[model samples]
Target: MTDWAAFTGFTGLVLVVLLSFAYVSRGVPHGDGASVSFDDNPDRETSLDGSRNDVELDGDELVSAATTENVVDGVSSTPIVPTPDSAAVSSDLPTHLLIANVAVSQALLGAFLALGAWYAEIPSAALGISAGDVPTKLGVGLALGLGLYAANRVGSSLSRQFGFTPDEALRESLTPESRAGWVLLLFVALPLIAGFEELLFRGALVGAVAVGFDVSPWLMAAVSSAAFGAGHSAQGRLGIVVTGLLGFVLAAAFVLTQSLLVVVVAHYLVNALEFVGNELFGW
Candidate 1:
């Protein structure tokens, strides 16, 4: 029998991922300039020839003895200074690409969240999880801890040829507030993130391939996980490889547990650790 459900899910996923990539490359709207504003009003209009009747200044008069016209020997003339308004305008010019990137990033994330709610049926209210459940939260934390350790170890080794150190690198990535933040994020934000990822990558993509290609669920899992890693290549070559490996782990978890819930929880835990460690400890 045709697995119509899986095929539909996979098609939806391809659309979502492509849109996300386009959005990230484009960035999002950061809003109008918040920098200083200029007031171009002058005290009085000065003559272009350098004469100002209000200031009693001679237009053509040479004020310095070293004026080029007054110089007896060969010398370069002093350069003319441009008006402040001209300089200000030049400096204040905005880059169109930068603005476009900002706009794209914001628009893309909004689109993804909306799609998740509309198509994936992830409840908006349930997006953020609670931290009150200590045992479950810690389990999530441990999964993240393991994933992070493994990823860091592998990533560090690969990047070591370029003089990067994993221990110091991980420490530098985390911050105190971010530590607290990720703890909350692990409990709250991670689930939401994991839910969407699983829906897109595992539930949608892997399921689709398994049905359409008449392949084993395991093979489908591997392919989908690989795609997930490739999506993160923007982080860097090594980061991409690490992310891909992480995706494999996630797929394996799903295969063993057969529960999207478990994999999502695990993914969230690992990401929380990574984000927190980077922000708090500077690793």
Candidate 2:
């Protein structure tokens, strides 16, 4: 039988070195290299389709071309007012679905990693709907949450520094009902999902790799986090960067919390606040 333990340790160490090198290299100045930042502004550019011009201009509103809002002036003096071209709507609809597929792909990649570890006989490779070490598991979940949020801040800062707007994920559709569905999907899905992720990635993988290889715990954590980031490729370049940053945060959390207690709490709290806005209402 393959010494799965030894193999994992070796893999973890290799990943640590690779990711560390990449992380450091990012700081090195390449000739003519410029940093791009995230533009919180959703409407910085005009659509080439002249969609904005057609929109009922209310004092020349600078609109993002991505918006589905009707651009033709409702009160045009012309006998036949121009309507938003069907082509524009058709082109945009596909793009929206494409972005969503990307996000889903990243998430699935993470799941694949967990399954791989299980096949290798790695303990704690994944958290079953029920798993050992309940308190520890919860702590890990919290760590994942805070780690992700911190990663988000770092990635946004990097985006701003680089002067690039990360591609926004295409929303499925613009509808009150769809929006509500999305909210339910995330709020209802994320807590359990997040918990499972932490258990598998931070708790199991990190711990197994660390023990298997007899490497430094910190190194093991770092390697797992890098894998976490890479798994998020479907999120696009920006998503990968964000995942990488969060991976670092999770690594730190695992190391510090040691029991996964605080990690889960932190994770749950961050998700609730960021997505559900429950924290804002003191929930």
Candidate 3:
């Protein structure tokens, strides 16, 4: 039998973390305008009006594509102006520092969760860390991530139609200047975010909660997905709703696969693709 005391502790902890994140993120500027985008070139970033930022990059730093009008399919179009959060890294937090800070925060949070689970006598397998076929799981994860991203694109378009603009400020604010920053984002921060979020939101919130209460995982998913949305409230209302839907999908996947790795990989790809799509494809 599961320990209700330990379960309650986990529930409380999750609630506090989600609420805190939602609170802090509300301070970040939300973009009502369209999202910032760059081209396939590593050197290009975004800002429009064909002007360089006042703050100069050192040495071989990546140049931006935002400040100029670029021709796509024979039509000259300028990128959307970034919100205050990314208008200048100088006034706000620098991009690299922000990425590093997030990486550190995720690491610390993951450690805490791990320790708590151990103390609660929760096995790793119960948390969706079973010995499974790695290759097949990864392939499945990749496909799911790609598929979800496509759905996300459609959802975003529909949200815009409904006059609910999806905020892209957080993503814009994380735009990197140096190659090192990209490395940190792709290798460290993204993986940590994926692992920690899936572990907490799906593995614990949906899977473990159902097992402990002998309740339907779908009911747990509904409850947990709300918290997932709350945690992303910095992204604004449309984002919160969209993210909540995405969370439910992932939660369902976790219920079906019983593997955190699947969701982790899928989650990582969704984020990574968003960054890449904007930076490289201007999508």
TM-score of each: 0.49, 0.46, 0.76
| Winner of 1 and 3 under lDDT | 3
Residues 59-143, model 2: lDDT tens digits? 3353433322322211111100001122322344443343343234324544555565556765443222234578666656655
Clashes per model (N, Cα, C within 3 A): 33, 26, 9
Query: What's every prediction's RMSD, in angstroms?
Result: 18.0, 13.2, 10.1
Residue 204 accuracy (lDDT) in model 2: 60
lDDT at position 15, candidate 3:
56
**Clash count in backbone of candidate 2:** 26
Q: Write the per-residue lDDT of candidate 1 for residues 1-283, one digit (tens) a residue.
A: 3434444554565545544553342211111111122334322222212233333334454243114212221110100000112211223223332222323443454356455445644332222323455566456546754765555545555555554322221112111233444344445434554566665566555544454455687887777766775554323334344556667776766655445555666665555555554555544
- What is candidate 3's lDDT per residue for 186-251, written digit by digit as tens? 898889888878888888877777776678988988988888876765465556666777889888
- Candidate number with greatest TM-score: 3
Clashing pairs in 3: 45-64, 45-65, 45-66, 46-66, 47-66, 47-67, 48-66, 48-67, 50-67
Q: Please give the range of 10 consecutive residues that has the lowest summed lDDT in model 1.
A: 74-83
